[model samples]
Target: MFKSIRWRVTTLYLILIIAALLMFSLTLKGFLEDYFITQLEDNILKETRLVRSLLKDEIVSNKRVKKIDRLVDEYSNEAEARITIIGSEGKVLGDSEQDPLKMENHLQRHEVQQSIKTGVGKSTRYSETLKINMKYLALPVKHSGNIVGVVRLALPLTQVKEALADIFSRVINAGLIAIIISLILGLSLTKRITKPIERMTEVAGEMAQGHLDQRLMVTSDDELGRLSYVFNNMADKLKNKINEISDEKNKIEAVLSSMGDGVIAVDNIGKIILFNPSAENFFEVKEEEIIGKYSLEVTRSHKLDQVVMESLEKGEEVSEEIEILYPEERIIRVKATSIKDQDEQIQGVVVVLRDITELRHLEQVRTEFVGNVSHELRTPLTSIKGYVETLLANDNPDSAIYKRFLNVVKDEADRLEQLIIDLLDLSKIESGISGKGYEAINLNQVIEDVLTIVMPKVSDKELNLKIDVPAELAMISGDESQIKRLYINLIDNAVKYTPNCGEVKVKVYEDDEKIWTEISDTGIGIPSEDLPRIFERFYRVDKARSRNLGGTGLGLSIVKHIIEQHNGMIDVESEVEKGTKFIFYFPKVK
Candidate 1:
């Protein structure tokens, strides 16, 4: 429904041209009509003077007078006029187109009366002789310096009226042609002027609709063309800016998707605007299903939702941890932060989720392990210090108690040495420092070597040993020393924790793809909650008993690291005072 400017301009131009042409044609027609009327009057006065002279020069006897009269009559007929001569008594004489005897009194006529008094006169009036409207010119005839008669010429103005009418007709025709031509030309000019502008307008409209690449084409150097140039430049700049923003957005998306932690972004309206691939995997939801939905509805994480709302309300950044429970009961840690713009206003909130449940357990184990190790090492260290001080103070080198004190010192020293060795092994494994010669090794041989070293301890405890290893078990590929160290730690733990007459069993087997080993003990079994964290360095369930037993608390920690280096898995299950089971699954050598 938008009206084009071209039509509006064309309409205005046509109006102006028609008005000017009409005025000019009317004025010209008026001037031509006036000129023609004036010329006719002058010719009439001249002819009348000649007739008067001819009448005065020879009174009715002269042939020349008749010829003059015939000439006047011929002139009247040719000029389409009537000529008349009036006597001084106001009687008509020598009247053309009328008999002189029947003519009315002419002395009182407007032109005739004026001619008698002023010698010449002219008037336009209805003529009684011709019975039509006429232009009358009169002149007084003079003889011997006195007026003898008046000559009057009345010309019917029909021919002049017709001529003026013809001129007006031509003016009207010309005016009509001029108006028509002006309209045609005006339309063409308007088209040329407005077409390019219209194109620019269309481009602008498209750009407003988010087509930033739209541009105008310049076709001239006029104002419209200059405007087009500016518009095209503006469009180009807008396109570039939009592309830059798109590129930056793509980069941000790539980073978010590539991250190890899941990322989710929410707008001020609490709708999820960005949900990366990691977030989908971490939350066990699809990006399409989550994006554009309310964050609370999608994540069901009230902690994150409240944090985002509070940050938005305060116009500040906020950080917090949110826990999301999976359908399988696995927990994930989501660290959320509110995004802010340069003005320190909250734009949105970003939540990054990491699977830290295992790490949390490990951290807890490390704390417990440190506490147990500190207690275990301090006991021996205190005993050694007290015994050494007593030996140094007493100068009785041969006292019977001196031997007992030295024996006590030796036992504590031995405990301390074992603690130091265990700590060193745990440290090396954690630092991924397996000594040289990493190769494929037989699981059964490794288990046997550990059993041989712990056989003395097992026999001293009167424990029952059971081995259920198969001869055809597949070899596990890893560092030999590390694997042997792994078995030694497992067997030592079993022998240390098991009571006398308790069962200690070792088993080696193979599934289709993996080689597995399990060591179990019938001892003070670990609780289910504590089973998940038993492998952490220096961890002990019973601090007092573990220290009395001289456990360095790093046995299971070293075992866990060695299994990891071998690309294997370790799992433990226990029931308090019933039993404990440890399983190691390693990739079988091809």
Candidate 2:
């Protein structure tokens, strides 16, 4: 119960009120008691002075001192108090409440002793003569500047005690009434103050629980009411700000989810705070499983860990391309940046990873293409130069030798021209400049035309050629010239790779969704390991044989690009010396 604010406030209020009432009661009681004691002492002192005047001459002799008892009794009756008188010889000459003859020596009395020394004295004590608690006052009776005796007066404190008791009763009664009223008022005020505060506390609790819509009601213009107003306004602002933050957070989440590159965020302690879907896929782990785990434990890549640690240590961005072998082998380009606050204090690290395997492969292909082009161009030029130089050195005007050398130069020139044409065609196809639009072309007719053109080469080699294409095969959507070039390259390659008298066959067919073409040749087949890379530009399985047959080594590569442009797939099957078959599949036009 004490833990409750309302109870505590009420208790505090009660305590303060009780304390004030107690202090006021005590002070007033003390003041009244003092006032009564002072008035009583004053009345006794006046009586004492009156008695001294009455006995001024009588106290000059022992005969007059004998009447001291009578005078004291008279004054004691009038004052309603006990009275005493003492003579010069330290004897009790008279006492209103005791026999003077039987009384003890009076000079030893504290009041009388004090009076002898200072002319007037007062004391309060339990008096032996009066047999009661009394207030005593004494004065020196003087005669012509000579001290004759001491006159002492005392009052029993019975009336003073009764008066003080009366005052105490009234004070206690009034104090009880005041305390009751104070308690009532304190509880009422405490309730009024604490009710709104309690409500605010409840609302604050709700806000802490993420219910920002809770608000306090303002019912007055008092400080508490104004505080409620401010609290409600603050809640409104908080709700709006939280909503804005949530929306922004959702936007960021969406962006991260859809990103092609992997994104990871770690806290200052190097624990994973955010792992996006791309990052999950890149690391082959679920984000939910790895959150709050250390980055090193999650990634298991020392290079990535080092990058993030370095960025955090240096308070700057660090980036590198590192390969990952776990989950899968991949070449990834990672960029790590240190996250910092407005104070320029390092907070965490953010890493972005881009898979660059395909890019690296393309770079390698480009390098190989440059070298192959140099070698291919150099070969024909070297042959032509040697033959020309041979002719020049002979110098004897031998017509037959000159004709043979010129024929050699012309064939080399023609081969070089074909190589340049193939290169140009490949560049155009790869750059999307060629076959930009598709037209319906009959595959059967394209093949027939290509076979007719290459039939002479087939005849020269005495190779048996067969064609098996459906005349009613579905037309495919592609450039007519590109389709013709595609068929011509496949047939030419098959004829060139085949030895003399080897058999070459072409078959074309159509299904419900696709058109297919297969070119089979009994040729020196591609090795099994080279099938994957057989279509790469300037890659020759038998380089010397390809060169002797006037092959530019770009024919298969051109065929591949043309087929890809037409949204077709081409595959090759081969055995070392048995045979090779090239298959093409094209989407059938509806």
Question: What TM-score fits each model?
Answer: 0.62, 0.68
Q: Which stretches of candidate 1 lie over 4 Å from their true place?
A: 1-27, 47-76, 82-373, 389-405, 457-466, 499-501
Q: Which ten residues in a row have the lowest lDDT in candidate 1?
A: 58-67
lDDT of model 1 at position 166: 85
Clashes of 1: 2
Per-residue lDDT over 1-590 for candidate 1, one digit per residue giving the tens place of the 0 to 100 score: 22778878887788788778777867877787779888997888777766666565532322343444565577677656687766667765566676666767878888877887777788888866568889989887766686767777887889888988887888789878887888889879988888888787788889889888777778789898898898888888888998899999999988887888878888877889888897787667998877789977876767767876886677655665456654434356655566778897777877667777778778876787677778778889999999999899888766778899999999899989988888887778778786785787877777778788999999999999999989877777888988888888788888888989999999887889998788899998998888777776666799778877877777787888888887888988788888888988989888
Against the true structure, candidate 2 reaches a TM-score of 0.68
lDDT of 2: 0.87
How many steric overlaps are in each model, in order? 2, 0
lDDT of 2 at 588: 88
